[model samples]
Target chain A: DAGITQSPRHKVTETGTPVTLRCHQTENHRYMYWYRQDPGHGLRLIHYSYGVKDTDKGEVSDGYSVSRSKTEDFLLTLESATSSQTSVYFCAISEAGENQPQHFGDGTRLSIL
Target chain B: AQSVAQPEDQVNVAEGNPLTVKCTYSVSGNPYLFWYVQYPNRGLQFLLKYITGDNLVKGSYGFEAEFNKSQTSFHLKKPSALVSDSALYFCAVRRPRGNQFYFGTGTSLTVIP
Candidate 1:
């Protein structure tokens, strides 16, 4: 348990609707990451933050956005939900050092109808 | 580009039998390899990682991975399988200083009782 909490463990929304998932960590980790897990696709990074107000896009950044205004909170938003965006989203935190392993939250399962 | 491949979509093993899940990766420069396990409806948990040092790396839950640079592989192994070990396993790769990691498609491991 890395002291990470993901809000809304499960959600169902209609297509074209906006949705935001929040990740809060008690540990003062320097890096936070958002990822989506789908069948046959493992876990793909959506976005990541290295520090407060410092964020970067990942390989699967399309249709998603993220923000981190504080070290303990990271938010991922789906501007317009689609059926393809239905997946399990996970948040992870890690320290700022080489050989550090990332610890993950339970995850948020989002469904787009 | 850094990426990992899990050749098997599923692996089945009997209880008390040795088990292995294959993983191969391609990356520029020295590779930082990792293994994770995910239970149903849960987030991925870090199992082991190979950053630098010994080729054989061990982690939680009696799991170990052998890093073979010549083969470009880091296959996860366990001496004896347990029913509790039935889950999805993923292999990931990252560059030494890269911000993101690339993951394999994942392999479902089933341990028969």
Candidate 2:
């Protein structure tokens, strides 16, 4: 509903396989973020990109990586999928302002076996 | 280090009755507090935030939260509950001077009709 779309709404993968998720926004916001939601963990930031080719790791960035090639496209990759990494992933974007709040995409449900 | 706490795992109320969800935060300096709601299989939606304004902050869906700096709390409130209001609620906090925020485990609200 935030003019954001996430690809592969549901994904099933095997352990050790590689997976990539894409987040595209129509708003062309400057800040984009990747977050994972798990039971009892709420939402934890995995990575954030403030501009094209400018990315930073978040609290739970281990084993996960992200790339922002352009303003509207932010990609997340799992080099080696693990069952423990199975969770819901959300993409958020915000205007280029210090006090601007975030707008979220619908999210992707990933399951690794 | 910054953190948010949602002590109650769940909150229940009847329709037409007042409802509240408790939230407490700990951070250095003036902290930015936020509330978000998550519907099943959807992304988290921004409800409201306490930046630097009056103690009480109002948001969408007739929801409001009171920020108490003395208690380090920002509890969300509603004058009347509705069945549609039942969902997972989260409290988040961040320092205005920083880029990241810490989220609570979340509280599930159930409004009985």
Instruction: Estimate every model's Cα lDDT from 0 to 1.
Output: 0.93, 0.91
What's the lDDT for residue A50 in model 2? 88
**Candidate 2 lDDT over residue span A1-113, tens digit each:** 68999999999999999999999999989999999999888889999998999999999999999999889999999999999899999999888755667888999999999
Candidate 1's residue-wise lDDT over B1-113, tens digit each?
67789999999999999999999998989978999998988888999999889999999999999999999999999999999999999898878888888899999999999
Distance (Å) between predicted and true CA of B2, model 1?
A: 1.5
DockQ of candidate 1 compared with the true complex:
0.75
Superposed Cα deviation of residue B79, candidate 2 (Å): 0.5
Q: State each model's C-alpha RMSD to the native.
A: 1.0, 1.0
User: Candidate 1's residue-wise lDDT over A1-113, tens digit each?
Assistant: 78999999999999999999999999999999999988878889999999999999998999999989999999999999999999999999999985688889999999999
